[model samples]
Target: MEAAHGTSHFLRDGVVMLGFALGFVLLFRRLGLGATLGYLVAGVVIGPQVLGLIGDAESMIGFAELGIVLLLFIVGLELAPARLWAMKREILGLGLVQVALCGIALTAAIGLATNFSWAAAVALGMPLALSSTAQVLPMLQSAGRLKTPFGERAFSILLFQDLSIIAMITVVAALSRNPADAGGPPGWQLALMTLAAIAGLIIAGRFLVRPLFRLIGGLGEREMFIVAALFTIAACAGTMELLGLSTALGAFLAGVMLADTPYRHELETDVEPFRSILLGLFFLAVGMMLDLQAIADRPVFVAVAAIGLIAIKASVIGGIAMIIGMGWRNALALGLLLSQGGEFGFVMFAQAQAGLLISPEAASLFGAVVTLSMASTPFLMMLTAPLRRAAQSTEQREEPNNDGAGALVIGYGRFGQTVAQMLMLSDIRVTLIDIDTEMIDVAGTFGSKVYFGDGTRIDLLRQAGAADAEALLFCLDGAQLDAGVLGAVREAFPRPKIFVRAFDRRTLIDLRDAPHDFAVREVMESAVTMARAALEMLGENLQDIDAAEQEYRRNDDERLDAQRAAGDYGAAREMVISHQTELAARARLRIPGRPTNRTGAGR
Candidate 1:
């Protein structure tokens, strides 16, 4: 009876929490406010201070912390060692400076403005120095700006912040230690323990993990693979906890270790759902932690503190961005996007309160300020959209040189570069335009003349000689940008023969409906090359392999046309199967040594 009652309580709480989460997320997403804001709002409404739907904020927070661990794990998986190394300048330089400056400035200001001890001020400053990875990454991704220069720098800074959490937690723990417990553990002993823990993690990851995964993978069971991944994360996290280390750091290290493994994609797919849900719960828990009564008691002070925090953080970030050579608009956007006190602030404050490092009243007031500042992130980013647009518009434009040469390439990334290089090798002069300034700069180092501007802008396209160009190539990576440029080119000057590089099958289909002389899949040549190599390894002659490949290409093109004409993928797939069967039968007949089973073998 007791077990049944406990189960019922669990179910009820889960349902209520999920209900509010889904409702708010959907509502906010529909209103273009984003799901992060929605989750936070939902938590506020259902929290103890409001409707009291969930009475156990502590329990919820305990579970929600797993979300942070998994979130960092995914981040680590996505960022390989080499990639991190490439961003070391930004991560180590900008990130360290940002944290140190913010921490010192905030610490001094807080200590002077309040009656808090220096230890308490330092603790508060540490959390304030960090920004929200969970909030900012998604917002930038949704805006399709993750590959842009500003986005890359923002991500590097956030990565540093995530790594700094380990050090910050250690500092807080040391500060919170009672002076009477001086005989506990020596500083060197603690340092040795930390080093031992790290060495053990590295050894286990290098030796034990790969073999275990290999054994599980040999079973050919995807479910077992997922189980293995979860077990790995749990074991690593639990071990770190037992060692008095950060579980998030352990999880992140585990992810980095497995990043180069073949099963990385599968692990990501399996863990993505859990990470997203748990992360949302983490956000919701943060909202529930806000002290509404405290805010009501001192509304003016709370409001002022929140505003002050944003201003201080933004100014510091903006200054750093400018120093790093970012345009004023992008610097401002970066500042606004990361001005908030992060979710970690709550964790640190809660720990401080529990350890008696900070008074409850002070924690309550600071918690309210952090929550308010976080809740304003989406609004602040939205407010900066105009500045970004104006900056884009003010970019330098080049006049169209009607006398230049062979082709006007719309994008100059990896894909476009290949096409441009092939043209140049044939002694054809190519003019390139790309929005990525970095790509343009690198291309210039190799003697490639490329303009840095949005290809979708008709004015930019015209200035690049769309009217007199021999051919126009739309090799832009972004799907929306590709389609936009295609439309703009067709409308402005339809004389130039247009060629588009389709990103995928869907893009190919979409481009097929556009006015293009040719539409090529980005990977079509690579796939053909791979197939040819496979056929060669199978002892097939070049003549036969070439014939087979040609036939296959012709059939695939016909199938694509049929699919487009019918506007039905199902029929197209069936047609492809039938065509494959016919081709196989014909091949057997053509081979003199191969037996044709037209009748019974015995007969």
Candidate 2:
């Protein structure tokens, strides 16, 4: 009866939590506020201080930490050894500098503001120095800037922070003083334990994990594969915890080792749902942990501390970015994006509380401040958008525009260069327009005349001879920019034949619906070439491969046209599958001696 009651309670709590989380996230998403903020809001509403939905914040936190563990593991899987090695300079140099500077600065400020021992203040500073990888990376990805310079730099710093968590955990363990036992393991013993755990994880990952996974994969059971993956994460995390090391560290090491494996993408797909759910729970737990009473009592202090923390961190990060030679816009964006205390701060604070390193009153207040800072990050990013744009504008204004040619090509980057090269080879007297001055200068060095200006602007387009231009070609840097240029050109000129370069299938679909005569996908030709080469390597005749390629293109075009006409991607995808099945059937019926060449006549 007791066991049954416990099970029932668990189910009820799970349902309540899920229901609240979904509602909050959906509403917040509808308002364009983001799901992270929504999760935090949900936690606050359902917390003990408000509705008293969950009585045990600590229990929820423990479960939510699994989300972070899995998150770091996924992060590790994305970073192959070669990629990590390539960013070593930024990770160590810029990352360490940011941490040290922030820690020292924050330590001094906290020491002056409150009455706390230097050790405690320093411990607090450590967590505060770290930025939210969970928050920043996704935001950058959603904005389609993860491949941009700023995003890369921000990622480098975040990677360094994740690695530095091991050191931070070690420090916290060393500071730990058990109330029941005065003579616990010494600092050196703790350090040895940490080192031994790390070594054990490495050895196990290198020797044990890959072969085990391969064995499981050979069974060809997806359920078993998922089970094995989970077991790996749990075993690694548990082993590290037993060794008095960070569980996240162990999971991360395991992920890094498995990064180069063939099963990496499969592992990611299997683990993503659990990670996302748990991560949301973790954020919700953070919200619940907020000390509402303390905030009410000292609202002014709480507000000021949150604002001050953001200001200090942003300044430090921005300064470091500039010192590391980042452009003003990128530096500022990096700063704003990283100006919040990370989820790890809560973990460290909890550990400190358990170790009796910090007083309950101080911990409560600090936790509230951290939560407030995190909650305010999305708003801060929104505020900094205009400044980033202004910085870009200032940088663009400094570039010189010399002369115009007969044909003006927008965007002189990789795609634009290819178009320009092809046109110039034909002696078409092509002129290039680009926002990036560096690219313009590089083109000039290569004896190609280029103009620096925003192609989306009508005035700039006219200055570059849009009125008398033979044709308009867009190979813009991003999808958003391409769409903007397409809209402007269509509205202003309407007569010139417009050609666009699409980076992906989605972009191709979007452009198909636009007023453009020609939409060439950047990767199609290369992909087809590679496919044809593979076929030739497999002993297929070159003529048959060419015929196959032509048929594939024709079918793809018909499928895309049907998809656009129906306005349903699902149906279009099904049509593609059905078409492919028919092709396979036809290939199977072909005579053994003679080759079959079936072609769709429509262009």
Candidate 3:
């Protein structure tokens, strides 16, 4: 009876939490605030400090941290190996400088303003150098800028911040005031173990993980994909935890391993819901743990310190961005966008407390400071929209799927499959797109990579390489092609030779004056082949059959031309071959003709 009542309590709490999240998130977003803020605000309202409805936020944080881990994994999926390598300069140069300078400056501020020793300041300040990836990434994505160059720059900095966690932890551990932590691994030993673990994960991803996913893909079990994706994250995260490394880092590595493959979109789709819910829960837990009483006791100090941290980090980062040749506007926007304390700050503070460097109250106070700084970022960006807009004009737009392909075939059905394979046979690089997930799964079984999306969407096509492709093949099965879409595609991506599939003679006629370079009636060639075979079966001479076929094609072309001009399927009825003319043709070919009614129009 007790266990059942406990379950009922959990169920009730779940309802209340999610319901609050739904209401507040919608309201906050309506007020131009982001969902993270909404979730945080919602948690605060229901938390022990307020309504006292939800308790034990400290325990909730461990589970909610998976949201962060999954988020890193998703971010890693966006960074293919080549893309990561391409940002090496930004990651090492700009990112390193931002973290180092920000950490130092914040450390000094803490030391000067507080009673804490230099060791505690270093332990606390370095982690604050990182920004909230969970909050900022969604904002960038919602605004459709996550793939832009400015976004890339922001991402590079964040990646380095994530990479710096290990070093930060090492520093905190080495400065440990606790005798228990003193016997823990040294910095050098930890670094070596991190490297070894990373190598092992890479090797496993290549040899074991990828093959497992492939087997699952071959089986075409979508539910199993969700299962496999979750397992991958869990297994990798568990390994890192076992080795005293960041579980988020392990999930990130797993995502990177699979990023270059065709299954990324599928994995992303499957794992996204979990990431969203858990991440919201993470922010909610963060709010519940804000220690409002601690902040209320020293409100002015918390508020001032939070503002100072934002200013220092923004100035340092903006200055670095400018030094790296970003426009001043973009530089400033980038600075403000990343000018908040990160989720990792809480973890680092807890670590400091564990090392006996700071008290729980000190950690809670700093955590409140971080939260307030984070709360201010949305408003800052909203007020600074002009700078971002002006700067974005000078930057390159997103190229999400620029795979250096020469042809983009926009359907993977029978027709698109043949068209794509022929291009491949001639050694042309091609990117294939279709809206069918089942087909994509099956295609993976045969080593064919088909992206899932509506190819008719110009944005999707552009991402699939339409701009750079030498040819655009619209091989949709039905009369899905039209003049307006073709014309729009031609104007938007004039570099590609647009070829469309016409479902019938009528569809061909409808598109006769469209902007496409070519259109083939889906059944025209097969009909011609069938006519030739029937003539051969009748023992007609090859020479005469060829002449008859040419004559028939000439009439068909003339009638199709007339129909296109008139924009009517029934137009040019007089141009079709009559029974008398057919009889004359039979006489000329020396074949008997039986009197019969003429067939209707093939269309």
Best by lDDT: 3
State candidate 3's TM-score.
0.75
Ranking by lDDT: 3, 2, 1
lDDT (Cα, tens digit) per residue for candidate 1, span 1-603: 999999999999899889999999999888777787888889999999999988898788899999888887877676656567878899999988888888787888788887889999998888988888888888877775655666678888898888788688767766655454366555455556666776788789889986677666556566787788888888888888787566776787778777755445456766777889998999898788778888999999899988988998899999889998888887887888889998778778876775567988888899888878888987786787799777646644332332445688888898998888898898776777765545655776887766544566565566456766778888978564345557767888877788888887667766655677888788888999998998788567888777778777877888888877876665477646464565574575473232335334521
Candidate achieving the largest TM-score: 3
Candidate 2 or 1, higher TM-score = 1
What would the TM-scores of all predictions be? 0.68, 0.66, 0.75
Model 3 C-alpha lDDT versus the unseen true structure: 0.84
**Per-residue lDDT tens digits of candidate 2, residues 1-603?**
999999999999889888999999999878656788889899989999999998787788898999999988888887766567877888889889988888888888888987877778877888888888888887876775555556677888898888788788888878877574356676668888888887888789889987777666656566877798888899888998876667887788778778866556567767888999999999998888888998899898888888888889999999988887877777887888899988888878877776678987778788888888877888877888798766645543211121224467887888888888898787776657765545555666777656544566675675445755667888886674455567778778765678887877667666655777788877888889898988778677876776677767877888878766766665566646464565673475451223343223321
What does the lDDT read for residue 350 in candidate 1? Answer: 74
Q: All models: lDDT?
A: 0.77, 0.77, 0.84
Q: What is the Cα-based TM-score of model 2?
A: 0.66
Q: Local error of candidate 3 at 584, Å?
A: 11
